[model samples]
Target: MANIKNPIIPGMAPDPSIIRVDKDYYIATSTFHWNPAVQIFHSTDLANWKLISYALTKGEVNLRGTNTPAGIWAPHLSYDKQSGKFWLAYSHMQNMAGREFNSDSFAMWSDNIQGPWSDPIYLTSIGFDPAVFHDENGKHYVSILEWETRTGYQAPGHIVIAEIDLEKGGIIGNWHRVTTGFTTRGCAEAPQVYKHNGYYYLMIASGGTGYAHGIEMGRSKNIFGPYEANPSGEPIITSSPHHLFSLGDPDSGHFEMYNPKSVMQKAGHGSLVHTTTNEWYIAHLMARPLPNTKLNPLGRETSLQKMTWTKDGWLQMIDGSNLAKMEVPGLRNSDATIQSDQLNNIDDDFNNSRYDLRFMTPYREQKSSWVNTTEHPGNLRIYGGNSFFSQVNPAIMATRATSLNYTAQTSVSFKPDHYSETAGLGLYYDSNNWIYARLCQSDKEDGTVLRLLQAKLGDRIDYIFDEVRVPNNFAEIKINYNLGTTQIMYKISENDDWKQLGDQLDVSYLSDEGVNGEPGEVGGFTAMFNFIGSVDAHQHDSFADFDYYKVINK
Candidate 1:
């Protein structure tokens, strides 16, 4: 048997929904505030994954003013062999302000995976993280979390199941309160339903989404009824599955529930898939934090665990231990060859007519007017729009920083006439928290100058160490990210030795549990990104031509 690595898809690819059609595997993940919503990844062996297509194209959703940790949430993908169609169910998180968590869910269908998908069919806005289940009778059912707003209720609310009509885009009848949770491990959401054996199984993400996150299961002979919890009386699988804590806590982030012995933390929100080999596996979201700390700057990532059926008919990891493993056993004699350079390595020469699907922009659709590789062959031309601080529209293109230790570099030739017009390579957690090393006009000289700046919750800090005047408009910028600290380096020419712009900046605050000064805010769940961008407050006509963009993970 081959060894399947954990975190099959890393760097912010959370809430994985997996499905298998013949020999192929596909997993759809959430893209908060990033355009081209609902990233779809394809994998043949489950070890190596590649970005293929997005469920939503431009004009599919409006994320113009979407805030941190809000936008497209969980996306569920399923294929109906009987109908020969693919269905995608997703939630568009419009607002999370004041913790109202207003969202709209919709479903789209296509004859093919990579498709001209049909227009969205409006689904219920009961809560979020909706999934479609097709039974043997060819009927469709939706399992969703009914978000409770009233005080003194089950804090985050229950998982409800209801029959839905695909064409009508509405429930057939009243919703069924299936279960609050299989166990007292409350804060259960992201419910997915599957029919196994003669029983119907309900899988949920429980114990909050922080240190206590886990996968819980219950099964019943009926689709909507009183479900019985797994005999373990606790999470069937989790990073801290052995650490019994918070069976009664009503809120999330029971930081005490963190499992120090395990390498994988916050392992939960699993989706199950049965392969052609009849092997069972669950794809879940797990986070790998820095050593001896819970600071997860990489955010929740996608992980896999080989599963098996108990003699009593419940599903669980093949091993009796519930702890997530760094390596899982693969199918015997499987011939899936994985590519060597799919994660944490990006070399973009920008000669292609279209931008790589790996790159994404926040809060707005990537349009040719703002970003174009064809405009300047071998270079990416990005015309500056509003500042990155503005969520409405920002001229930025980035990829998830899959590794904490990596070097991100870019070659740019931007002639910024004013300080308001700048272009550079940097790291971004959100508009409120980001560090950009930009080249702009020098007030002290005729040539451009490099400056390192940091924005934390709209407050800006400009680093003034040693300002170097560029000999020409062309400059090579590099950022060496070492765990939570980053060093910005630059040189006038590629042949010249790199120069440090500022002392290493501590950026540990740019994480899911950090930043965002809003009261009662749970920080942001979105991970950090490596970006190449420009800010133009002087004139929108200013553009930056990036000769190349590259990132090498250490």
Candidate 2:
């Protein structure tokens, strides 16, 4: 056996939905407020995964004003052997204000996993985390959390199921209210159904997506009835199961439940799969907050753990430990070459015709104008459009800040005629929260100058430094995000010593729990990102040329 390692996929990759099509394994995860939603990954062996494609590529959904953690929710991926088709089901969470939880569910199909998937067919808005389960008898069923609008009811509501017609849009007849869980861990969601010998199993995420988060299960003889909880009444897997706390907490960031002993936190929302070797593993979402802080800058990542079935028809971790691990046993004699750890640093020279699959832009539908690689030949010419504060058309190319401690650097040359036309490097969390060190209209100088700025919870703080003068046209800008603090640095030459732009900025708030200052409620779960962007509100033609982009984790 090989060491598969925990968090098979990292950095804002949450709500994993895994499926095996023939010899290949596919996992689709949620992408909130990020365009080209529903990130898809492929792996020949369970241990090594690679980002291959995205499901909603043609601007299939509009997320222009989508808020943090409110764009695309958990996406369930399935494959039908009889039809040789791939199915993806997901929720477009539109609003979270006042806890309305207004969302719409839809499903799409593709003949190929890497595909031109069919237009989203409407599913239901009963709640989020909608999943489609295809029975052995060729019948399809949809399982979703029936969001409780009534205050006195089971707060998050029950897990409901109904036979769905994939060809059409709605359920066949009526939805049947199923079991919440074996026991009340509280806040049941992300319900996935599966079939085994003589029984249909319903697995759900419990404990409110925080420190107490875990996988809860129930089974029934029929597809949708009288389901019984696992005999233990506890979650099958979790990061913190030592004590149950915050059972009904509506907040996603249970920062109060930080487990000091655990390397992984918030381990829940799991999907299962069986390898060709006849081994079972659970793919789920987990988080790794900064040491001693409940701030999770990496957001929720995808993790895997081996499991087994009891003779009494229950699933349990192979090791009998509910705590999530940083390193887990890999597949038996699995392929190890294509793993994410293969590159500790990513250096892109803007040589490829298409942007690397790892690069992403928030709420952007790319065209030749916004981010043009051919306009300047080898340089990535980013034409400025909107400020980072807008989810609309911010001319930014960002990649996940995968490690808690890492340095992201890029070489950019920009001449901004006006203050509104600026370009440079940034560490962003959402449209509202971000830090930018860029070359903009100099307040004191005649030409463009370098300055540092910060935005916390949508409040913009500007001109942290006004003395840095860029004598050369190009500047190598870098942001060192170590743990939870961010240090901005710049140099005129690549070989020159890097100079600090401002004081070491505490960016602990660039986390899942940080900027969302809402009281008594959970915050957003989107991870932090490092980006190269240009803003030209004065005139849309102003552009920045980025020679290279690099991210190194040390």
Candidate 3:
């Protein structure tokens, strides 16, 4: 049998919603503050997955000025077997000031999974983590966490369900309040509905999305009303299965609950599916820290757990433990040759007439006006937009940093007339936290130079004294990142030996819990991204031609 490993989809992929249609399985994940949101992956053997398409591709939502971890939340994908249509429900978290948590939930339907989806139909302004359930009677329902603003009420809120109308694009009636207390673990959200036998099961993510995160299940004979919690009185699956009383706590970083024994922590927010062969599995989000630290640079990733139903109709891990496993059994008779494509690295030549689907941009949609391959054949031509600090339009094309030890390199040809124009590669966590190695014009020397710039907690630090003069307009830039440290390097020619540009900088601050943000909240959730970007605050006419970009993981 194939031994399905943990983190099936690694690096910045979180809040996974999985579905199976026939023999094909598809998963949709959250993309906070990143354009082309709602990443979709397709798999056939359940052990390997590939990026197929994205949902919000055509400027469907405006993410301009979106803060870290405050854009797209959970995206729930489900297929209506009766109508033969795929439905996606997601939350656009607009604001989080004062813990008000203002968000709008919307749904879009398409005849095919990879599709020309219809415009987003407004569902509710209730809360985040919206999930759509297709009932057996041709009825549709939506489950969401109702944000609680009152002081004494439950901190995060309640899981509520309401019947929805697809054609009318609204709820049919009042929302039914489900039980908020699920196994004493608080901060419950991402409610998903599933029907089995003669009962309706409501699965939720509880104990926050931190060290104590887990998946809990409840079931009711009716769609809504008096759902009974799992008889185990604990999460069905978690990295830290130890008991804790954290009710009413809305904090997303439960550092005190960190389990040192498990390599995979923050395991929760799961989506379930039953294979055609009657085996069951849960696709959930997990994290692997940088060895001895609580900081997770890779962010939340997708992992799979083998599950089975009890004789009394309760779901539990296949091994009958609440602890999340790093390895699980796959198909009974399937070959074990399946492997993930993103485990090591990727190299893109930009020769294909189209941009790689794995490449994504933050704040703004990737359009040909600023980034395109057709402008210069066999090269990616990027016209610098705004500075790295601007959440409006930052001309950056990035992919997820999947490994702690990896080298990212790119060759660029640019001659900047002004000091504001720069082009090179860097490691980005958000607009406020990044380490950039850029090639720009030096004001003192009146020549091109390569320098390193960093932004930590909104403070900009420029390595002015360490700037290295480039001999020509063309240079190769590389960043070697190991654990929490990184070093920038560049070479003037293909045969020239690489020269280190700066000291080995400690970049552990570019992590989920290391940066600065709203009080009691994790700084960011999108994780580290290796990107090639340009900035042209001068005339916005300067462009950089990148011949290729590559990432090699050791």
Q: Give the candidate number with the greatest TM-score.
A: 3
| Residue 278 lDDT (model 3) | 95
Q: What is the lDDT of residue 36 in candidate 2?
A: 72
lDDT of 1: 0.86
Candidate 3: segments with Cα more than 4 A from true spot: 338-344
Alpha-carbon RMSD of each model:
1.6, 1.8, 1.1
All candidates: TM-score? 0.97, 0.96, 0.99
- Tell me the tens digit of each residue's lDDT in model 3 across 461-492: 99999988887888899999999999888997
Q: CA lDDT of each candidate?
A: 0.86, 0.84, 0.91
Runs with alpha carbons beyond 4 Å of true place in candidate 1: 243-251, 337-343, 444-446
Give me the displacement of residue 310 in model 1, in angstroms: 0.8
Residue 225's lDDT within candidate 1 is 72
Write the residue-wise lDDT of candidate 1 on 1-554 in tens digits.
56887778879899999999988999999998997888899988888898999989948899898878889999999998889999999999887766577889999999988888899999998899999998889899999988888876775788999999998889999899988887667878999989888899999999888878889999999999789999888888888765454543444666787888888998989999999889999999998887767788898999899999989898988997788887898876786553342465999888888767789889888889889987788899999978878898889999998987889999999888877888988899888889888888786647688888788877988776667777688889999988788888888987999888868888877788776833455577889999999989986899999998998988
Name the 10 consecutive residues with the lowest summed lDDT in model 1: 335-344
**Ranking of candidates on TM-score, top first:** 3, 1, 2
lDDT of 2 by residue, 174-217 (tens): 99999756655677899999988888999999888777788988
Evaluated at residue 317, the lDDT of candidate 1 is 89
In terms of lDDT, the best-performing candidate is 3
